[model samples]
Target: MEMSLQSMQLQLQFFMHKADDLHSCLVNGQGHVERDALAAAVVSFLYTCQPYFNHLESTVRSTRPQHTSLALNIYTQLLDIYQQLCDKLEQLVLSCASYNLLCLEETEPNSVSHFCVGQCQLGQLKLTTFLYCKPTPYLSQVDTRLYKRMRWNVEKLQVGQKTDKDQGGESKEREAKTEYYFLCYEDIPNTHAETDWGRPGFSDGNVVRMWSIGQWVQVDPDPITETIDDWILCDVPQANYNKLLFLGIEEPSCCIATDYMQQLLLLWKSADSW
Candidate 1:
C-alpha cells in the first residue's frame, strides 16, 4: 500500500533531526579519526532521504495539486539538507586524504580524478593511472635516504651469503625490515605556490618552478603555462611530509579521504548540471 504524505513527511523529519545532531557533533569536534564514521552516517542519511525527495517530487507532479508551493517548500528543505551533507562529507574526506586519517568512499571516475590530482605526487603525473595507486606513494621522486638503505642491504646481503659458516653451531642471520619513501610538495600559504581567486589573485609559483625544473610537462604551455600547472595543482602543495614514520624516515604519500573525493564528485556533478 502507498504511504500518505504525512507519513513520509514524518520519516523525513526524523532524519532531519538526526542530520541536525550529526551537524552539531561535527561542528563540535570532527577530525581525521572520526571523519569516516561521520561521512558514513551522512551517506546513510542521504541514501534514505534521496528517494523521499524523488517520491515527493513525483507526488507533486502526479497529483498536480494547487498547493505546489507548500510541496516546493518541503522539497527545498530536502535539497538543502542534501547539499549540507555533501559539504560535510567533502570536509571529512579532504581532511582524511590530506592527513591520512583513514576516511573511506569509492573509486568513481570523479573520485579517481580528485584523488589522482590531490593524492599523487607532482612529478609522478606522467606515470600511468594504474601505477598511481601503488602503496609506494610517490613513484618518480623518492628520497635518496631510502636508496641508501636498499643499497646497504644489496651489498650486505651479498657479504652475508658468502660467509655464513662463521660460528661453530650458528650461522649469521641478518634480519631487516624493508621500507620506502615518498615525496609530497607543500605550498607555503602566502607563497607563490598558492592559487588566486578568480578576478584578482597571485598564482602558484611552486608548480612554475617545477615546470622550470623540467619535471612537470603541461599539455598547454601557453603564456600562462605556469598558471596551467598551478591550476592542475590547485588542491596540491609543494612540500609536505607523511603522517607517520618508516624506519626513521617519514611515510611517503599523500592520500585524499574517500568521503572528500565523493563530496568533490557531487560538487562537480552539481556544477555539471548547472
Candidate 2:
C-alpha cells in the first residue's frame, strides 16, 4: 500500500515531537542525567525513526511532485533530524562509559593504577579481565588484609602429550592430551625478595614506597619448576592500596575502563597476553 506524502509528514512530525520530549527530559536534570537511559532512548529513537527516513526518501524519489521545493524542504528537515539523532547517540555512549568508570573508583577503590612508565607487565594481566580469587582464612588476627585475585587463561604449549602406542607389537609414539592452566593472583607482600625497589617515580625517602606486592599462580597439576617460574609478579605501590585497582591494560581511560572500550563505549577491553 502506498502512503501519501501528507501521511509521511504526519509521522515525521510525531517523531519530532517525541525527540523534543526526550531532549527536554535529558537536559532538565543536568547534574543527575541517567546516561544508560539516555543511551537506550537514543538507540530506540534511531530504530523507530529509520523506517520513516526510508519512506520519506522513497516518496521524494519515486513521486514527481508538482512542488519540488516543498518536498526537498521536508527531506532536508528529515536529514537534520537524523543527524541530530546520531549526535545524541554518540554523546550518550561517551557519558555512560565515563560515568561507569567514575563509579568504579568509589566501589572498588583498591584497584586503581598508581604509577606507569610506558607499559607495566603486572598491570597487563589483571586490569581489565574478570577475576576469581580463593579467599583464605585469616592467618592471624593481626593481619586484616583481604585477598587480591587475578584470573589467568593459560593454554598448553604443545598440541598433545607424548605417549607410546602399541602398533603391530611395536611401540609407536602418540601425542598426549592437551593441558590448560587456570591461575589466580596471590597477594604476597615480600615478592621483592631483598631486591632494590628501582621504580623511578617516587622516592623511597618519602612516607610511601613502591613495592612488588604479589604474583599470579595456579595450583600445580603436576609439580613442574618451569611452569611455576613463569608466573607474573604483581608490582604496585603501598600508597595505591585504597585506590581503584586495574591490571594488564595498557591504556585505560580510568580505573575500570580501557582505551578500546572508551573508543566504542563498551566494557573495558582486557590487555592480558597469557
Candidate 3:
C-alpha cells in the first residue's frame, strides 16, 4: 500500500510537536548555554527537514514513476534524520538538571528604548517586524537588535455556494469557491538559507509558496507614506472579529506558519457548509 502525503505530513507534524516539547523543556531548564545550543539545534533540524519533505510530497503527488525512487530516497533520509534528532532531544532532556531561572544581569533603572519598526522577507511572507533592542556587551557599542515581533494573521474563513439565476432564464451556473495566497521569501546572505531550507540541490535567491493567512487584510495606501503601511496595525472591519496575533522571532515559527496554512486550507477544502 502506498503511503499518502497527508499521512507522511502527519508523521512529520508529530516529530515537530516532539521538538516543540523539547524546546519548552529547555526553556524551563537551568543550563543557559546547553539549553540554548540544544534548542537551536532542534530548530535548525526542523528548518532543514521541511523543504525536503515538501519536495518529496510534491513529487509523489505528481505520480511520475521516474521520480518515485528519488522521492523514496528523500523520505528515508528524512526519517533517519528525524530519528537522530529525536535521540539527541531525548538525551538532552534526560540529562538536564532542573534549576530556577535567574536574572543574569541588572540594567540601569531609568533606561528606556522605543520599538523600531522594520520590514523584511520572513519565510516567503513580506511582513513587518518590531524590534526590541538593548545595549551590546561593550559599553560603548550600539544596541543589539533583539526579539523580532511579527503578526500572525488569523481569520474565520467562510465557504459556501451561492444561488443566482440568469435574467429571464432558468439556467444555473455553479462555481467552486476557493482562495489562494502566495508568499515569496528572498534569499539574504549570511542567513541560514544556505544549508537549512529551500530546494535540496538548488540555490534559488527566492522561494515562493502557495499559502493563505487568516482573515485577509485590505491594505489601503496611506495618504502620505505612499508605501503600504502595516496592514495588521490598521483598523479594518475584521479587526474586531479576527485581529492579527503576534509572535516573537524564532526558528520554529518559520514552519509553524506553513503548518497553520496547511491546516486552514484543509479545512476550507473539506468543509461542505458555510
Candidate 4:
C-alpha cells in the first residue's frame, strides 16, 4: 500500500514530537520515573519509522519527474527528523545507563566512588541561566575588519507574537507584535579563490555563522578596550524560546544554537584573551 506525502509528513511529525518529549524527560531528570517505558517507546518508534524511511527513499527514487522535487524535499525533511530522533535515543540510553549505575552504587556500599577533591563530584544537575544583553546600536554601520574574513547581516522581522488570556476568556490581539533582530553571517575561509572572496554565498565546506537576536550590553563591568563591540547571537534555549521559530524551523527541537552558545561561553570563561 502506498502512503500519501502528507500522511508520511504527519507520521514523521508525530515521531519527532515523541522523541522530543522523551529527550525533555531525560534532561529534566525525570527519567528515573519512567525509564523503562521511555526506552520501550524509543525502541518501538525506531521500528515503526524504519519502514517509513524505506518507503520514502523508494518514493523519491520512483516518483514521476513532475513530483520528484516535492518528494525529495519531504524525504530530506524526514531524514533530518530521523537523525534527530536517533540522537535523542542515544542520549536516552546513556541517561538510563547512568541512572542504573547510580542505583547500583547506592545499593552496594562497598563500591568506592572514584574521584579526587574538587574533581567529579556527584550533585544535582542545574540548567544554565542566560541573560539578555542589549542590542548593538547601528550594527550595520560598524566596521567588520575585526571579524577578519567573515560577513554579517541583520534582519528585523516579526517571528512571533504575545497573547494575553484574561479572566473573561481568551482575547486575541494582533496589535502587540514583538519584532526581533535576526543576525546571521557566513565565515568564509581564506583558502578560497580571491575572485570568490567577499561574495555572499552558502557553499559546501563554508562555516555558517551563528544567528543572534541581541547585541552587547552597554555597561560592561569588565570592559575590554581591545576588542570591537559585536552583536550577540544565540539559539532557542538561550533566547528562552521553546523552539527555533525565527528560521522557520519545522523540527520539534534544535540544539545547534544551544550547543554553539555553550561552547562559546566555555571558551570565554576559560580564555584570558577575551
Candidate 5:
C-alpha cells in the first residue's frame, strides 16, 4: 500500500507538470497558433490522461481510510491540476471554428471536433454526432427506429425551409429561425449519404444512434436576455439516482468541461471526502 501510494504521488506530480506546461503553451500561443494541431493535441491529452484519472480516483477512495491525510492531499492536488488542463482545452476548442479541428483522415472523425458531446470514459475518445431536439416532459430512450424517423423528419423540414427561403427571398426571413441544430459524424461509407452535413451510413441501415439534447437544456446563449451561458455534458447517467446526467460548462466560455470534474467536486465536498 505504501508503494502504491508513492507511485500514485509520482504520477500525480508528473501530470501536474504536464498540465502546467500545456496551460502555459495555450496562454502563450494566442494569435498565431495552429488551431487544428493544438485541438488534436488537446484531445489526445484528454484521452491519454482519462485512465490515470480514473485509477487515481478509485485509489484515493479505496485507501482513504488507511492513509487519510496523505491520500486527501494527493487527491486535492490532482483535482487542481486536472481542472487547469480541462479549462485550457475548453478555451482552445471554443476559440477556433469547428471545421478547423476536423480530423478528416481519421476513420470516425468527430462531428464538432474538440467539442465533446458525452462523458469521458476509459479507452473511449470518439466524439459523436448529436441532435438538438425540442424538450419533452420526460427523458425518452432513443432507439434506432425512432432515431431514423426523427432524422428524416428533421432533414425534410430543413430542405423545405431552404426551398422557401430561396423562392420567397426576404419575405421568408421572418420564419427562418432555426428550431434545431444537427451535427453529424463525417465520412461514413455510403454513396447516397449526405457527407456534406449529416452523418454517413444511413443507406446501409447500420445507424448508430446519435446523442440528443433537449431544447430546454440551454445549450445556446439565451436570445432574449443573452445572459444564459452554454452548457456541456459534464457527467453521464450513473447508477445512483442522485447522480443523473449533469450539464454544466466552466467559466470564461472557452474552457471545456471534463466528464467528472464538476460532479466529482460536488460529491467530494458534500461527503467531506476532500
Candidate 6:
C-alpha cells in the first residue's frame, strides 16, 4: 500500500481528533488535556515517520535491487526524528503539569521564590535538571567557568546519553584548558512531590542534574547578591508566563520512548548490514 505525505497528514489529523475527543468527553482526569496533547504529539511523530516507514516497506516488497546506502540514511534519520519527537513530547508533558496551575499574578521578588506561591511541584513528569547561569559575563576564573559549563552541558541535552567515545580516536589528546563535564547523578522519580528530597540531585523541591556537551545550568539557591528562585530573566523588566521561557535560556531534556525502543532501533540498524 502506498502512503503519500498528504495521506499521512490526514491520518495524523484524524488521530489527533480522535484522541482529543476521547480526552475531552470520554476520559476523566485532572490532566486529561495534557494527556490528550501528548497523544496528539505521538500522532504527529508517526506522521513524520510514515514517509520513511513507507519507503522501508516498499524496499522490502519490490523486486528491484535495493540501494542499501539510501535505505540506511532514511532509517537513521527516522530513528533520530523518533528520538527528538519523544524529547519534545516529554517537555510538553512536564510543562503541562504547570498548566492551569494558578498563574502567579503577584510577580514580586519575594513571591516568586516560594514554589507553593508562584511555582508548583511536578512529581510525575520526573525531570532531572540543573540551574543554569546567565550568559558568559565579563568572564571569570577557570574552575568557576568549568562548573558553570558543566551545568550548561546538562541543560543542552535534548535526548540521548553519553556513550564512551572510540578509544582509538584522538580523544585523549585534548587540550589542557578544557573542563570535563561529568554526569552528577541519575534522578529517580519519587511520584510524590509532597516533600523535598535531599542529596545527589534533589533540593528546594527540584534540582536534578544530567549533562551533555558544554551548557550551563544555574545552581540551586542561586548564588546571587539577593536570594530568589524564579527565573531571574523572567522577573527583571517584569515577566508573564509567555515571556519567561524566552527570557530565560532553554536546556535539553532527554527522554526516549522507552529503553526497549532504543534497543529495537539499534537492532534494526545492525540487521541492515546483512
My TM-score estimates for the predictions, one after another, are 0.27, 0.26, 0.26, 0.28, 0.32, 0.22
Residue pairs of candidate 4 with colliding backbone atoms: 212-233
- Deviation from native of the Cα of residue 266 in model 5, angstroms: 17
**What does candidate 6's lDDT look like per residue over 132-181, in tens digits?**
12222111322232222112110111233344567533322222211112
RMSD of 5: 23.9
For candidate 3, give the lDDT of residue 11: 63
RMSD of model 6 against the true structure: 20.3
Per-residue accuracy of model 1 over 83-197 as CA lDDT, tens digit each:
3433443454454345433333223322311221211111111111111222222222434121111000001111134344555354455543222222323223234333545
lDDT of 4 by residue, 50-116 (tens): 5655555344333423457765666555445434544544454455446552221212453211110
The lDDT of each candidate is 0.35, 0.35, 0.36, 0.37, 0.37, 0.31
After superposition, candidate 2 runs with Cα above 4 Å error: 1-3, 30-33, 65-274
Q: Candidate 1's error at 259, in angstroms? A: 32
Per residue, candidate 3 scores C-alpha lDDT tens digits across 49-146 of 45544444333323323457866665554444434433443333333323222111214332212121222222223222211122212111222111
Q: Tell me each candidate's RMSD, in Å, in order.
A: 21.2, 18.4, 20.7, 25.6, 23.9, 20.3
TM-score of 5: 0.32
**Higher-scoring candidate on TM-score, 3 or 4:** 4
* Candidate number achieving the greatest TM-score relative to the actual structure: 5
Whole-model lDDT, model 6: 0.31
Report residue 264 deviation for candidate 3 (angstroms).
13
